[model samples]
Target: MTEPLRWFTSSHSNNGGQCVEVADAQDHILVRDSKDPHGPALAFPASAFAAFIDGIKTGELR
Candidate 1:
């Protein structure tokens, strides 16, 4: 049997109707548009995903 996908969203996501959802499992991280839950999802390495989050927190991605 196939494992079900577990999804998560940013804690900072507001009720303003704009947000992104993420899913982390195994060695990869999955990102997708919250507005289109059944649409495409992008997969990234756990380390790369962590770095991206760190960059966002450090104001290097803004």
Candidate 2:
């Protein structure tokens, strides 16, 4: 049987109205809007997700 996906957000997220939720399981990484927990999620490859985060941290992409 396939395991259900688990979601988590950054602990620092509480400070801001903007928050993101991520699910790390299966072959792809899942990202969704925390404001709408039941909304459709976007899936990306693990590497792609990592690069996206790196870009954000380095201010290469926003």
Candidate 3:
């Protein structure tokens, strides 16, 4: 059985009303719209998400 997702928002959420919530689901990272929690979600591998975050910190992602 899988555990329930515990979604959280980043501290940089004051940049207007647009934001996303993220949750860790074992092997993947789940992302959902903060405006519509019950809406569709996008999933990415944990490693991939980590890489994306790293790229963001390094200003490598545009």
**Backbone clashes per model, in order?**
0, 0, 0
lDDT of 2 by residue, 15-56 (tens): 464688999977799999888988999999999988988999
Name the better of 2 and 3 by TM-score.
Answer: 3
- State which candidate, 2 or 3, has the greater lDDT: 3
How much is the lDDT of residue 12 in candidate 2? 64
TM-score attained by model 2 = 0.77
Colliding pairs, model 3: none
Q: How far out, in Å, is residue 62 in model 3?
A: 2.5
lDDT of 1: 0.87
lDDT of 1 by residue, 1-62 (tens): 76988887767778665688888778999999988989999999999999998999999999
In candidate 1, stretches whose alpha carbon ends up further than 4 angstroms from where it belongs are none
Q: After superposition, which runs of candidate 2 have C-alpha atoms over 4 Å from their true positions?
A: 15-18
Top lDDT prediction, candidate number:
3
Error of 2 at 17 (Å): 6.9
lDDT value for model 2: 0.87
Report the C-alpha displacement of residue 57, candidate 1, in angstroms. 0.9
